[model samples]
Target: MTESFPTVPLDGAPGMPLIGFGTWLMSGSECYEAVRTALDAGYRHLDTAAIYRNEPEVGRALRDSGVDRDEVFVTTKLPPPRADQADQVLAGSLDALGVDAVDLWLVHWPPGGARPDVWERFVAAREAGRARAIGVSNYSLEQVDELTGATGVTPQVNQVSWAPPLYDPAVEAGHRDRGVVLEGYSPFKNTDLGDPVLREVADAHGVTPAQVVLRWHVEHGVVVIPKSATPERIRANLAIDGFSLSDDEVARIDGLAEV
Candidate 1:
């Protein structure tokens, strides 16, 4: 929507930025500062989870950034333990994040394997206008099917740990068939950035291998959230929009799955 970065259309239909800032281990002032740095670097999407216990810091940075709430896409997840009190947990997240409604809300994991009971509350929250869109994380396509079958409501997105080495065409196709947007976390953690293929492609694009990896995710239209506490890497990671990858290059990267 900002036109600064590409976005994938969400389920009920809204543009979610292809790149988002991930907050996993960051906390306190470090979380605050990194989030501030990310916002200053033109990141319009922010991902945080209740389990991270840093939603308040993330919220603080967003407010301090002076960016209008509507201009940013915010996501928070419900931890498994809080599944029974889903509504209260969402309320607490809202209070911590200082927002009335989050752009997206997710079930952190399977929560006892596709617990539709938790999903039913998510559906109610959406209807109550507490969240704009809802989805799941670390869910198999079958689990997604189970939720949908139980409630007739399919998750809009599925967030998982992904990178080139883990690429599976069938898994990608499965989400497409289900009309679910795929979001990938731990992009660098799961990648071999030093691999020659990545090095060669990075050289071709005049970027770092990490940049090439991030661009690869965007190339496949998969949402990637690369996190960093360092100022330079934070900005460098968001600098991938300047170049486009060749078809051959993408094929080579995809082939990394076999190697």
Candidate 2:
């Protein structure tokens, strides 16, 4: 069921699912249970961060869920402040997750917004096999280019706060042109689900506006990680694969962007 989910091919790793389960503010049992439910709901991709301080819970859920580690796409991040201790911090993350390496590792944010030095450490992790792929979060296109210029290694992904209201075709094009996969977070928190356009589209498809928003991301090839603790919603988020939006529907949602 997971193998057929829409995915974006990565250079040296398994294809990343277009839709994933994001664990940001969640922690403790809440985080673990939510992840278990997500995996059971057919979410093969899971996104967590060191700063989120829930890798242990996420790992526990993964192990307890009985999903083959190789079958699940797991991602974690490095806090910018840990740039000087990248090796140690990553070691800790690996130990906590009980994995030899993460499918993807990201610099949580740019250190001073231009630390190719940190990116270098990320490259080292990948080369050393501690990370299958390397990337950055909360980065601008210029910053992404700066790192690439400095290290000669382009980050495989860039995660940012993305939603229909925050959409920009030029930005998406920039990532595409540079060969960076754009991953979005907070799909619901960042969107106004009550918007008329979303409602109209949802009504037509017999799905909620939230599902339409998620499907919208996949339509553009942008990876989306929607976080939810509710069991029903966890399953519902992954249900987006059953239907697709028309080009007209996509354009209508794109028009919701303040950009």
Candidate 3:
């Protein structure tokens, strides 16, 4: 059975679903089905990007799910190459997704355009009501500061690669001090779920290792989007609300970092 998912508040809009379903490599009918399955499994947040080239499929799934558009929180990204044409790029995404406005729009990566210039365009999108909230992905602390310092507009969220193996308290503190919500992607890429420590925690909670790791992110207040096309994993990923990780357990995973 699917579990009830919760939400985390953003700076300028309604709260975002804490656990989002990610569609990175998925496309065509597979992407549509994955999204449909995710929504049916109780996932209210869906994350996609222009680079994925799956917006239309995702939009179709959303329409077929019988779920009200307002009930689901959708996030799509702006690639760096389109930074100069931010307005057109976002419009194209909206058209592809068949949505009037996305709940949150993000800059997919940092290398395409000048950080300040790109961020300014993103801010313009929010101002134009094309996106309810705007943020950045794959940005470092310095770049995040540069955007705010230059444009006087801070990004509401920073989506980056974060996992037990690469978690850094200092960098995370920087995000918190800047009032940026740390939304983590590729959460399962950096760690070995089969590690005895993680397995032991999973055993204790009678859940999977992935659930243990996701719960750890929850306890730290980080938004996690775990991608999976399988229905069983989709349901399992959102079933994290029923358990709580001990402070000691969280510290153990924190201390297990290789970097």
Best by lDDT: 1
TM-score of each: 0.98, 0.98, 0.96
lDDT measured at residue 146 in model 1 versus the true structure, 0 to 100: 97
| Alpha-carbon local distance difference test for all models | 0.93, 0.92, 0.88
Worst 10 residues of 1 by lDDT: 6-15
Deviation in angstroms for 24 in model 3? 0.6
TM-score of predicted structure 2:
0.98
- Model 2, range 102-215, lDDT digits (tens) per residue? 999999988887698888889999999999999999999999989989989999999999999999999999999999999998899989999999999999999999999999
Report the Cα lDDT for residue 208, model 3.
91
Error of 2 at 94 (Å): 0.5
The TM-score of candidate 3 is: 0.96
Clash pairs for candidate 2 = none
lDDT of 1: 0.93
lDDT per residue, candidate 1, 162-245, as tens digits?
Answer: 899999989999999999999999999988889999999999878999999999999999999999999999999999989989
lDDT of model 1 at position 176: 90
Runs with alpha carbons beyond 4 Å of true place in candidate 1: 11-13
